[model samples]
Target: MKGFARRQRSVLGVADALRLGFLGLKARPGRSVLSALGISLGIAAAVAVLGISASSEADLLAQLGAAGNLLTVGAGQTMTGTPAPLPSTAAAMIRQIPPVQSVTATAYIDGASVRRTAEVPAIHTGGISVVAAEIGLPKTLDARLESGTFLTEATIHYPAVVLGAVAANVLGINAPGPGILVYVGHEYFTVVGILQPVTIAPEIDQSALIGFPMAESAFNPALQPTQVYLRSAADEVPAVSRVLPFTANPAHPETVRLKHPSDVLEARAKARTQFTGLFLGLGAVAVLVGSVGIANTMVIAVLERRREIGLRRALGARRSHVAAQFMIEAIVLSLIGGACGVLFGGVATLAYAAVTHQQTVVPAVAPLAGIAAALAAGSIAGIYPAYRAARLEPSEALRSGE
Candidate 1:
């Protein structure tokens, strides 16, 4: 009997194992809390990083959505390095594209100065620009009218002018009405409308827009488009961009420069991953520190509880039972920390999003992955101490503790 192996013991049930595990932690409340804090901090860092990244990416994507499928085309230089102006009919050519929903172009009128009145010194020109604008500009730029109506077909040949937000302020034209005029190109143009703001083209916000007909007939007949703005189906943006050069300038397609502003937003959204990797590295370090803390705490616990281990061993408890008890206690401790960390991280992400005016976003896998990592860390840390505790000889342990 002395030389034979002991029969294997049965494992504890789930509920009973958890009960014993909870009691073991309760016996050392102070040390248990300190151990769990390390785990909580690690999990919190990981979860917060994920949540904040998702939120910021969501904000950028939302802005892209607002931009729609807008594209800007400008004149490019020739092989000789001389700058070129976009064709006068560039907007009309772009409109021929089937997917093109709206198209507008603007040409700067040179040698023009806008003043509140003729009495104002020429040097006092308010830095306002005079541009030839299409009637469809409001739709193309998705601009809002703050005062009177935009240039219409009947008003295109007349001296009607529309003021951007900044231009209106400088010209002392708060509201558009009859008898209100601003001196431009040695002529007085009646202010017909004031625009709120233009997001796609912020330069438009500082300039005065006049109808193309008025610009050609009175201001400058040879004026050509300096910039073109257009919108097409989202799926057709690439196709439209490819052919825009040929369509705008058949003889010299190379003299056109096209840009998709939405592509810039998409690039920014993808760039979020760069920061995510850095944040995740920080989180990994935190988790590593937590794992070390757990391992240290468990080793100390095993040393301090040798007598308890011996008494249980003397009372017919198997070696496996001792190991199971300590291992379960470690898992429970880590779980408690993981849960608290999830709550803390979620609140922090939401609060930050609200302050920054970004949409709150949290990936579904974040919490599950966090908890699983905690469980894995806890299990690995429990192994050495659990085996050491189970290896003690009952009589020798009891004698050594005396």
Candidate 2:
């Protein structure tokens, strides 16, 4: 209500409000810092959560986007997600679909052991379609070499293997140099090549990858493919889904199953909405307490300045002027706290990302949004106190101590 009168004072514009706020902060540096701390904590928590959310989203998209029109298997309503079966004959027939760009079967190898003499347990091993080298894995793996190259179409039929960075060192496939022979599963297989290190997931520590056909035919017939990756055109996705038996059924018709990012994104958004509401509620509580604190301070300031107010009224100053000064001071306090909160909050986000090993990435607008929110909340919280200050009668205020 008194905002216009507050703005009427050229000497008490936003610039002056800022300057006087600094004066107030300087008056009680300890209290000012403590007040700012609450806001800082609130913003910091929001920033950290936002950073993690962004990382999760980016990681998902990165993993999925790499497919380049590819589709991975869906777990069709079982105890756990399982890879559906598609025989070589059936897969070859699925290529008949107009939208099908490429088809490949991938199987993850669990409890796999490659022994030259002894066995090292708990290594991640899997075989993907031969096309995985062309599309799925990174190009750095392409540059890495040992005695041979990454497997090809011919190698799928032959007994060839590529060793991961860990595998090459542990088995002594290439000792201080080039090619050496190693035995995997009692079969005399040469270590055709050594691979650059690749992560099964960035979160995990160790794993290995190989061709699925090797696991199925040569390694263990009991071994089953955990997934199949397929690529299709953008417009063809709907068409592909119609044929692929993504749903649970005994006599499935299609060879491949497709999943889209939009479905996952919607689910994540719902989860995020829950957290966002929680943080907003906590922030509201903090700001409310801070508002109460400000109101108490303003009341004390007015009581002490009662005589000064009367003297100003006698000198022809308006009641609104008195109210404006008190209100501006309160808002000024909040604005200062808000700005400090932004700085500390930013530091918190950076520290968390560094400690967690996730990427240290933040949205550019978060800090700005935080600061704006702070100012808006402060202005709103100051209204009632400002109104009470404006309504004071000069005569009564002058006689207060008497």
Candidate 3:
């Protein structure tokens, strides 16, 4: 009974086990760092992928929320397969709807090409479209001017144009000024403004917007609107969209097509989620490889430390103590790697978000989950090595060490 009490009292405590575990790692610093690096790489990849994906989704959601109330009406094809035109009064008629907040329209000027200079060939239109826009177009579309000013009531009747973001780039015109002019249709139109990209209306990003009066006088006297854009009260968007086609063209509702611009953003968000899953699978593969590396390193550690294991066993240490020491070492190693990974991932996320002009958003679960995964990998990887170290016969180990 006394001997049994003494043996029980000699069992290793948690602190003692941890101390010995760290001591073992300290003895082989090179191997310890290399083993931890494997885990670090895997965890860093996982955390960074999740962080970046979350940031992208957050930015998309923000854009959707801001523009969700916007709806567009465009003329569709007629039964004869020819282009159908919307009535010039469509914007005014749609504004009469109770839920409609603002309305604007644009007329697509066919056969009208815009060029940087009149000397450039007419065939090199750079895929740009010339559109006749209302003075209220920028406000209705929620677009911003990168430089200069938008079309005003006083300037709409003159040969003035606002270059869309893409149009400005294609024309190699960075800013709008008094003398900056682009050849439109048969004449030179002074550039009045340069617009930033409009997320809800990509077509606006590739158009050279001229006012309706100038378009009518210079391009076509009987020009009809090709598209109408409107904003509705937040809660009334669905109802407004349902009645928009009928309201825009009472003669033929089917000839007017209605679209909610936010739907495209929602689809893109779904696609990003699917791609995130693929990236997570790749991260998992990396983790599995790291686990293998840890297991290999631990098995080698046990083999190389046979003499120490035997000395401890031949003294007062029990098999369970030996196992606990090895297990703790693995957990601690992976814990270190996880901490470093989290730090690296956070920095990477911030840098990427800043460069891409996206909002930074890291899910709280990402770092916690990464640490937990590392611990789990460590626990599993330590099992076989710990067991093998504990199972060594003291006598045999001592003989082999000699």
After superposition, the stretches of candidate 3 with alpha carbons farther than 4 Å from their true spots are 1-9
lDDT of 3: 0.90
- Tens digit of per-residue lDDT, candidate 1, span 1-402: 899999776566778878988998899899888888888888888888899999998776766775768989888899999988887788888899999988889888887778888888877767889888989888887889999999999888998889999999877788999888988777888999999967557688889889888899996778899889999999998898899999988889998998877777777767788888888888778777877787788888888888888988998888988898889888888888888777777888888899987888889888998899889888987888889988999998787677
RMSD of each: 5.8, 7.9, 1.9
- Candidate 1, clashing residue pairs? none
Candidates sorted on lDDT, descending: 3, 1, 2
* TM agreement with the true structure for every prediction: 0.74, 0.64, 0.96
List the lowest-lDDT window of 10 residues for candidate 3. Answer: 1-10
TM-score of candidate 2 versus the correct structure, residues matched by position: 0.64
- The TM-score-based order of candidates, best leading, equals 3, 1, 2
Report clash pairs, candidate 3: none
Which regions of candidate 1 fall more than 4 Å away from where they truly are?
1-11, 65-68, 106-138, 141-223
lDDT of 2 by residue, 87-204 (tens): 4344445556678776544454544456554343324222211111222333311234434576676665555666666666655556322335544554545445666544322211
The residue-by-residue lDDT of candidate 3 on 122-220, one tens digit each, is 999999999999989888888999999999998899999999999999999998898999999889989999999999899999999999999999989
